[model samples]
Target: MSTTTREAAGRCPRCGAAVHGDGRFVVWCAACDWNVDPAPPDEDRGRPARVRRALARRHGEHLLAETTDGGAPGPRRDPAALAAYAIALLVHGVTVVLAVGGTWFLVTGWGRPLMAVGLFLLALAWTLRPRPHRPPEDGTPILARADAPELYALIDEVAGVVGTRGADLVVVDAGVNASVTTCGVRGRRLLTLGLPLWEILTPQQRIALLGHEFGHYSNGDARHGRVLATAYRSLTTWRYYFAPAPDPSLLDLLVNLLSLPPRAVVHGVLALLDQLTLRATRRAEYLADSAAARAGSTEAAVGLMDRLLVADSAMTTLRREGNAAQVVRRGTEAGDRADGLWERLVADTESIPEGEYERQRRVGALRGHSVDSTHPPTHLRRARLLSATPVPAAVAMTGGRARAIAAELAATRRTVARHIVRHGFPG
Candidate 1:
């Protein structure tokens, strides 16, 4: 979940201890692990319109509750949001223009040597901008195109259906999610599939999940991702270079104190960009969810989201016990028993909340994401899907056959296993 005021808001209802958050969701009492209910409020069930969704998708969480029943969201032509975003980007453009123009004036018009130092600062910021090296797999298993024709073919057909560009790489990561991203200096497009996430879903649900990622591509979110990523990297790099120096001694402290004003100026600009982009980020998620509903069955899309709630907890439990390497090793070992692998993942995920604390954990995971969250809360996303009036498409697949397909990726799984053992598990 996105960070919320609930972390320090009040006492836990069950235990009455000072409440603390586990970050995404599940505020708890450190003494007893008791928690407040995290589910969407039942009293407010008004259907959300598009403009309202776009608005709620911003920092205001309660705005989602102001919906009228069965009101479909509007088209992407959200003038207010678009205008806000334009204004933000325009602000960024103006900064660039002023910097460039000022630098030119300092260098040519006024030949003042010391004043010309400002141009050097602008040049330094540009030179300090980041360059990409490689796309991160984050310990995700890789499936080569040549080795897995069946999986590649499925991805290809799905991309064609969604009318988006096909991915050059398929990554099997450990999560209850899937996504599309561009990485590497060449900006290679990647399609990431959470392998264990796939195990929890029916074939149709899997299709809907994949469709969700492709939806981002079709809606231009994926393309925008690379651009924003470059900007973020550049900002971070510049911030690091301009930030206060480390204080190991009195001399270092004095240097940082002297540099405070310049650091504050740089930080102010960074914060401004973050504030402006928050709404658009949430809008992108809403749009992608709608695209998923249109490309696949709404039922399947909803089911996939429901599964994700539980899967987050399951992945944590599965990995935290030092079983990440074991899971991958076992996946590669299962030949005809691939169904057993799927069953194991599903059973553990479902059984995560046996104890009181665990139950609290589950409920907490179900709550909404934080303000300025990349994706909206699960309930909000589900509500949007339910409220959307787009035509749903039917998908065909055999469960047993799909299991066989998953089984066939043993070699790639083993490759990931070797990498994990060599570098230590990511978790």
Candidate 2:
């Protein structure tokens, strides 16, 4: 319900008078006779039923009930859960083993007392391993200063509909992509948009994009993602330090001969843990997409897909051009002719801004990466949105509008393609 005001006095959109008003809901442009109220009152807004229904459809009714009813489903202490548990166990077990072993070795005069001290230190390090903690900042610095006020507003509106706290907005000076990261004392959530994407998407498309990011945050996808990352890190650490080894050096060989079996057991356990974490991550992505559909407009989800594709295509062209230019500039600087027709083509394309080129490249890269990565492919996601049945009327309206927008976007892509072919992509 709290609103922030813009500093400058502006002419009323309806009447030409200097005025002050809240920027969130109302904007008065005096000279052009423009008074724009972009958002509705807070009390009248709530999470959309369509979003709930879609979530129920994808994740089942019980999931929503669990989140709202405050039922402790307890920890997901399954096999993967066991893996995390095992790490704790191993830490304790190793400490006991070292303490006992060091005492015996010292009593028997088989090794120096320093070995006992060293083992204790190692045990302590394992037991007190630093977990990934959120950064201290409550808000994302990048989102706060990015050029797109409308994008942030849209995200806030959608957050209202889903009954989730809005993420701190962030802007990466990158191109054609968006992602949500959690930072803060407890890993509080943050949403980041690429600058190029802000300049490119229409208002509706932008809302859909924000919806996707919110979907991830609302569904606890970020937490699940972090878990998976942690599991991988744990697995790698165990493998690197504790795995058994055959060593050629006489002293090293003696050490490995003693530790190999236990190390191998630990390695196997961690590998199993890694697999369980990965499965959880993939499931989380699907659930988040469902949440996004439930939180705001299903149409927004679909429109977001279309815009993503458009942005990707644009970026691809830009990257190709950018690389070519880099090669030519280097060749020219070295007094060598830029040879090869393909090389010439690349050089011609490289005149575009580096920021713009990087944006396009990132989009293209996202398409390739999302496949093996946790997030589902964009085309598959779009299909899921379209196939979702028995949609509520409000969601239907939003979806209908979104479809129209997608059609327009498709046409626009074709126009841009033609222009690129003729002009070698705009600068």
Candidate 3:
């Protein structure tokens, strides 16, 4: 250690080294990268305020067009986007009917059998479809209420604020993301929270994360979630099923030749729907971000997102540090052993000077904004939040309650860490 290494009043829990902070929220140790800290509510100018302010001042006018809260006539009813999926399904049904009835047309010898054969090939593709891909699963240990009552209670408290009654299951995972999804035809709702995300933010930010997720439920995004997921998967199935020419067998060769036209048609339809959904999805993200800001404070909601980016980047360092095969086999127990990885990640991020940190955040925002993905740019989302009215979201879960939630999620986090280290972070 350098002779200049001075001890501070507070020590890093992760590294057992003297840590420093601006006396609130943001905390880190220079010796190790345990930069995670609970954020203070109502204030977070932190060390980067000047840089953020300068950037804001530079882009002040553009902020107005970003719109205030509740103002964006978001694609509440994105007819064009929604219609593409509906029409695609209709076309699929028609093709199914044609495939079945086209054989009779062939018997009449009045029509070419190739089209009928193509239709039949399309139908066969549906049968050969792979199982629907479930929403991203962390494969971590599931925590029953009995195992973590304090945590479940905190969840219920947050749930009340977010306006969802509760979830069927709570999955503890490794990344810095949380999501709500439906599990089965019965529409069982599942809420999964990533501990790395939780570990970095304050109590308020935690609520913001949960609020953002449940916002999906309140905004009817959950309903749309299931439908679109099915649509995407079904689209994928046909794409995969009819994708390749059959093997050289006579029967395979004939079917392969016939499937081509139908395959082309489905490909064209899939491309159209994907483009439409991207727009709808971007709108949905803004709406959800809006809901989260309203449910938690804008600061917390936005901070959660900002810090989440850091956590996400930090998680990648573990790729070379963990045994994927062992984690896949041992689950949470394996994650428990790699507990310090999060600390290491945090330390690395924290060691960077404020200027560099801000630079990186800005560069990341700029570079990421151009991606051909469904979600909107992080900078745009932040801009919208900055322009919108700030609401102080009421949260009953705080202080001791918050700590308990953290403690309860510990075991689940360990297992999730294994899953992440084993399989890697989800995109």
Candidate 4:
């Protein structure tokens, strides 16, 4: 059940304006946003800001236009997708050649120094081998059906409604986002639900989130396909191994010079692959959003997108709460802050005004902010969701069942909150 809502608590320290929140949540001025998001924005590591924004704006504008025109492309045999597969196969061919050549060399030069070359080639092949997705071994406990029957049942219901198999495993964590991915050699589905995100969302929004993630499975996301995915991983490994050494010594400089050509070649292939799959990947996301709407209704899906737009702020709020906990506990026996941690987060997020959401929408448009580099811009997603025909939710979240799921998650909520309060979020 959700916490009770309270009225204005105090004045904003920065703006001398009304600060509205329950005491458990941070009191912040909506006018100045003081204490609303204290953490600095995360650094962008993937692409230059200018380039990302440009691409996002272009894609977003084009997609919005297409949505308006009712010409959104459906699943089709994209030449770009086929080209990406071809490139991936070509990349895998290199590994095959190395493996075969190494075997031949070892056989022909059994007792010769050429056997050393064979070992080297074999090692290179191993390094470049296609890697399948694997379940993360991080210490977070996995929630099997036996452990959380209600939660799993809910997920299964949503998956069924969304036309995909239920996740084989579920992980609860401190993040402000959720995702579903195929993991393990057998391609078992895994769903990672961020408690922070879950805490702030309504039950229907949660259903929408799950539907959107599982939608990737039935939607044929180009990025998730085995061939291209493994090829991307292999290329990344190649990049890492061939990357130039920092502050190079003389010998390191010689090695770097030797590796320069292969590094350049690997880089070119990676870029080409990215370009080839870019459109298909973006289209897949929209299709997933459609699935989300189909499962949870357009209103809930739109609400989910709004939640995503403010996710960074949500993270920032959690970080600040964690820091506050640390400060309050200083010089005292370290104690549990987990109990009210979620209540505070829920309050803080709920305290945010509609104006703040509008501000975030504008900021997203100007900066092309998205859930990630791969997703389309949040404003565009919201616009598209709103533009689509509204439908009734296929999966219902009854209060009794919602409470059962919460009860199932009770221990996990505390554990995740305790971790966040102690160490802040992992990068």
Candidate 5:
């Protein structure tokens, strides 16, 4: 379902190694890293995107340098982090002011119009209020502790290694990624494990993934905290409400012109937040990777990075399989075609050669691919894991336990396969 073509290119200018490309991707030396961070594509050529990229690169470089110099990442009180918290508080303060003003108008209004104004203000306050994160109601299965005790036991062991609580819920979905986040007002931990990614990982790499997620909690990642995170979300919601409509009508243009000042203020606050938290968040990721290394050994953590580097390939394989089922529908039901999709995806991902991994690493360097903009570059993460002091795995998995976990997930895998068949894999 997945294929690659390769041909020799010129020698690397830096290392004299024979460079190669498929004529479709970048050609670069995997040995000495020449042309790896070439000029990025035109899609990100906008001034705002360029600025974000520059800030991200600077943050990553500085943090990587600090860690390489033997600095261990812990919660540090920096002015930037303080400023970020201040701005977040200021945003929440605005919502509170709106609520108070609305309530005052409602209670003391002398006339109907004043009461209507109060109602409008209250609506605005509600719209701008900070919200806690919640799990999506998209029918993705959520497994409780009793449903998968052995799997929960494994996660609990990894959580202990990372000095955090195990997930309260295990969510399965048709994705090629995994993450841990808190949900709802109580800050309940939830592990959203992507079946496609889980299927391809070795038992140890799975431990590393869990460790990296739990590390977010142990390392005090501000983005995972409701206070700052909800503030960011509130600001984003404000920005969205003020954003100019695409293909604007005259009325829309008038609204945009009238709202320009507040919009500018919101944009400025958002930019300030990004600047303040950029360094802290990026460092949190590096520290989380360290936790992964501590939990599952440096080798497994680095292997996890390699798998992430080629995640696009895994998704492509899923897309191909899904597409094949549709294109070759020879009187077969969707369920018939969806059967064993996860198995095929696992096979395809495992069949990737070591050479392909190298190419992807180079490509990741070239494109500055990361889990997201909040994260440092994948190349940097992999490099840090390799350069950091190695630690033996604190949590090891036996074959029997691994099989039991798989058995627990078997029904969920079937559900995910059906969802993928109907919706295809998410991009």
Candidate 6:
């Protein structure tokens, strides 16, 4: 009779244990240590209530409520929008001027068709520009199963508040920074994290970092970035095309000579336009940091900023060391050969650092060597993050939900680091 009763109660699919009814669609099985369901449960019907009960068991109802309610306003895009608008106007004005001026000169017959073809090609390039690819499979899968579920849950919760799609998650083996990318038209969004970044940040700090990245997604920055990049490329193409080619024809020569003044004027206008665009990009970074603060605690955001600076410093040190090693190796190989002028010069340089202490001194000097860098200095980024104000409660309440998801990402770095140490790099 007992066996019959046990069989009547559905067993957990995973553990094969008998289950008892939980009033909701779920049945709890103590023996199997799992919940079993005959059918998919409706999330809207009882999930929230069940979740509330579960949270209450762990954190108490008050703490749970506080966590659910506590949020800061996300960063505002007003400055970015205004800057973008200004750039658009500048671009439009320049384009109009170029079109009109080019048309006027097109009376030379050869110039007219060439200019038109050039403009068409530029437009095509903008429209068909390729996007950056997803990080390769050889990259790290930073987040493990245990961490990923929690992270996804947090993302779902936050996405509800923001009324937007949660970021798509990916982990790259590259030890570096994190960035969010977008794909698809309206509903699809992709977010990627670097394994090195995951390894370095604590849970709260990770949450803060993710908040900033998602803020960019929520603000539609990906779309805006794409537009800006495409437009910039298109403009460059147009500028090149309309530029005068070497001409033997007298009429072409005359037109080219006359066009020089207008072209110079256009160049200045474009420079102003470029400045505006760059200013907007800088402002966007500030806004994203503010968004991070709003989504998580200001303290968490600040911590993340600090960690990022530390990581960047570490990377810089590594790169310098690698460069020094290469230089020394090259110098040694050249000395062994003793064949050419270049080799002799390198051998002589290597001879200058004869002892360990002298080599160390040389390496130390090389540390100060300045290489042209693409991004702004880390100090500037840190200063900006520090100076930024905390996001408003109202904005945080809705915008900051994604912060919790980042908290779940804390374990990812450890898993990735372990794998990396054990397996070496994924090829």
Highest-TM-score candidate:
5
lDDT of 4 by residue, 315-354 (tens): 8778776776676755352244667788877887887667
Model 2 deviation from native, Cα RMSD in Å: 19.9
- After TM-score superposition, what is the CA distance of residue 424 in candidate 1 from its true location, in Å? 7.0
Worst 10 residues of 3 by lDDT: 39-48
**What's the lDDT for all of these models?**
0.57, 0.47, 0.60, 0.78, 0.81, 0.46
TM-score against native, each model: 0.65, 0.48, 0.66, 0.85, 0.89, 0.45
Which regions of candidate 1 deviate over 4 angstroms?
1-34, 37-127, 130-133, 136-140, 246-248, 320-343, 352-372, 389-391, 399-404, 414-425
Candidate 3, residue 6: how far the Cα is off, in Å: 17
Expressed as tens digits, the lDDT of each residue in 286-316 for candidate 1 is 6566555555677888777777656655556
lDDT, candidate 3, equals 0.60
Worst 10 residues of 1 by lDDT: 43-52
Each model's number of backbone clashes? 6, 13, 4, 0, 0, 8
Residue pairs with backbone atoms closer than 3 Å in model 3 (clashes): 33-346, 33-347, 34-347, 332-415
Please give, for residues 289-358, the per-residue lDDT of candidate 3 as tens digits: 7767766788888886677555534554455345443544655555444676566555554553453344
The candidate with the higher TM-score, 1 or 5, is 5
Candidate 6, superposed: residue stretches over 4 Å from native: 1-147, 156-164, 169-171, 184-187, 219-225, 236-270, 316-427
* lDDT per residue as tens, model 2, 269-318: 54444343444444455555555555445666665565555554446545
Q: Candidate 5 lDDT, tens digit per residue, 1-427?
A: 3344456578888878887765434566778777665655455553344556667866677678997676456656588888888888999999999999999989888476788888888999998888876787988899999999999998999999888889999898888889897788788988999888888888899999999999988987777777798898888898888888889999999998999999989878887777788778888888899889888889999999999988877888888776776665544666875777877777777766566677666666666633255788788899988887788999998899988998998889888887777666666
Weakest 10 consecutive residues, lDDT, candidate 2?
333-342
Top candidate on lDDT is 5
